[model samples]
Target: MVLRAVAVSRTQEDGGRSELLRGTGVGPVGGLAASGLVLGMQCALLGVGAGTGLLALEGARPADALAYGAAVCGTCALLAAATMLLAQLTTDATGARGAGLAALGLLYAGHGVWAAERWSRAGAWSPFALRGAIDPGGADDWCPLLVAGAALLVLLAVAAAAARGRDLGVGLIRFGLRHRRPLRAGGPVTLALRLSRMQLLAWAVATAAVAGVLTAMGENMVELARRGAVEGGVLGSLLGGSDPGAGLLDYIGVLAGALACAQAVVLVGRFAAEERSELVEAERGTGSGSARLLSAWCLVSLLAAALTLGAAALVSGLVGAALLDTTAGDALRLVAGQWPSAAASAGVTALLGGLWPQARWLAWAPLLGRVA
Candidate 1:
């Protein structure tokens, strides 16, 4: 849902048309609301359809499936409204999207905690309360829909008001233009990193927050360890074999590795976006050389992937050391052990993106299997 909203927002804000709109928009607030409506409607339909179809396939009753779909649709529209507000808060679409991604990760962690700690019976005001929006197994209780619907309305209202007050093509909170000294990037690699600073910051913060949430659930993980699903593997051993509270760490570590690889795949695609936007062609015309420009992103993608896992390992390791009664080294090892996988995924994506750009999505095949 976050991705869908981000994609739609970016499409609506394509660089050139935005400048034109700035001069000509008759009613910025109405236009903003209209665009947000379009985003919400599209996301709502996709969410409902996908949720219903998936639930039906699981043999859920028609009433239950519809209920789940409605919950999903409400959440999707809420996220779209959120993205609209975020887009105004941050100066760039990518930053807004990155912030949205961060929020999504935090919510996912919250959902995990909600389930692990069994907070459903708690009062509506309990912080861990989650509705059927994320945890379908808890769908029998639908009281959360009112909260979600209220949030959606509030977000849309705030977004429209903010739109009315700000000039088009700029954020509500503008960064200072003054600088003490000239800022310069040494090379294409440095430039690429500079441009992606916001995204990297978002990923790091979100990963740490998630790790903290997992650490806080350490006591519950002891009960989870009884399942023994995380036992008996070379990698599993590094995660503390059969230790109390270790099974959940090991399992989530494995999933986090797949996420790291997914990040690599996304980073490699940045070059493709640049190419499609003619940025690469223009840079080549400036004598930057096509090879140098593309190669910069290739190296950046590999480094970014490594940086992600490194950050995850560091945070999760701290969580283990502080709360889980386990050695930090073991937890760090489990989380960071997937560097090779991330590097390989980067190579595959960069290769396919450079060669058969039209079929670059094929690069995602390995990660798909890993995730499944």
Candidate 2:
């Protein structure tokens, strides 16, 4: 979503019709479609890479890998369509990221809730169940893929309609309440915080939801661990030796840290958007020196990323302590242990963005490779 917004800003810099025509030919919606094409191609390449890696294993077949790659690409395109639709619906870049991620959280949480309750053939109905259809199961079921395609079409249609209703650069609908009075005082740091607050809030809520669900299923996790699922893996050793519950909590903390880094990538993308739109230079012209503005941008984005991760850990720890009979101190401390890694990720992104803004996208490569 952040990328989509940046593409929009880049395609229509300064909201000028000449640029829009020269860059996108038609309008903002066309620019959005072009971005979707690029993203879809990237997703296809990633899927092919993953499938090729799988095929390199001893028992893997080339045909199966190719099929899975195709399926994965289709799934990625559908998901990208949904994200682009959400990006088009928002009035600003930050709002696009916040809304797109929040929607993803809800979709994933809804799938978890549905999976937890419906033990039967619920895969046919869950919108976020693309993993099942693409993985080792290889069941040749195309219903879920068809559903995703339908959803993609719907999202594309709606986004186009919304775009048609709005002006060239503005959104179809605005978010938030308007203040009557215009008297306010804020520096660069404050403005950065304000821009990133919604993104932080959305991530916090998503993390809490995930943690709550994990806590609720503590007994099942314990049973799985006792069944030797948690005793034979490197992850288990890294998490803890024997106590599966604590190990699980730590594992989640590690994942949360990774997610925090992903959020940092989104922040860097936002910085790119601001630069494309000349917002950074305007701020400098308004008396915020270039060095100070850069400092505040990095500091505030890093702070927002760090604080959101901490708050999520704290919330999840409290919930685990309450529902899973775990000590709050242990849970909080274990989760906090992962914060430094996330902080380092944010720092790396900030450094890349500050020193070599043109290559800021490179900062995502390490973290994304780790994830893949």
Taking every candidate in turn, the Cα RMSD to the unseen true structure, in Å, is 4.8, 3.4
Q: Tens digits of per-residue lDDT for model 2 on 243-358?
A: 66677677667666667777776665566567767788878777987667766766765776667667767766787776655677756766656666666766777788778888
Q: Give lDDT tens digits, candidate 1, residues 176-251.
A: 6465356477777887888787687677667767766776666544544445544555434543455655555666
Task: Point to the candidate with the largest lDDT.
Answer: 1
Candidate-wise lDDT, in order: 0.68, 0.65
lDDT of 1 at 187: 73
Model 1 gets an lDDT of 0.68
Candidate 1: deviation at residue 116, Å? 5.6
TM-score of 2: 0.85
Off by over 4 Å in 2: 1-19, 22-25, 119-127, 176-183, 227-240, 268-272
Q: For candidate 1, give the lDDT of residue 147.
A: 78
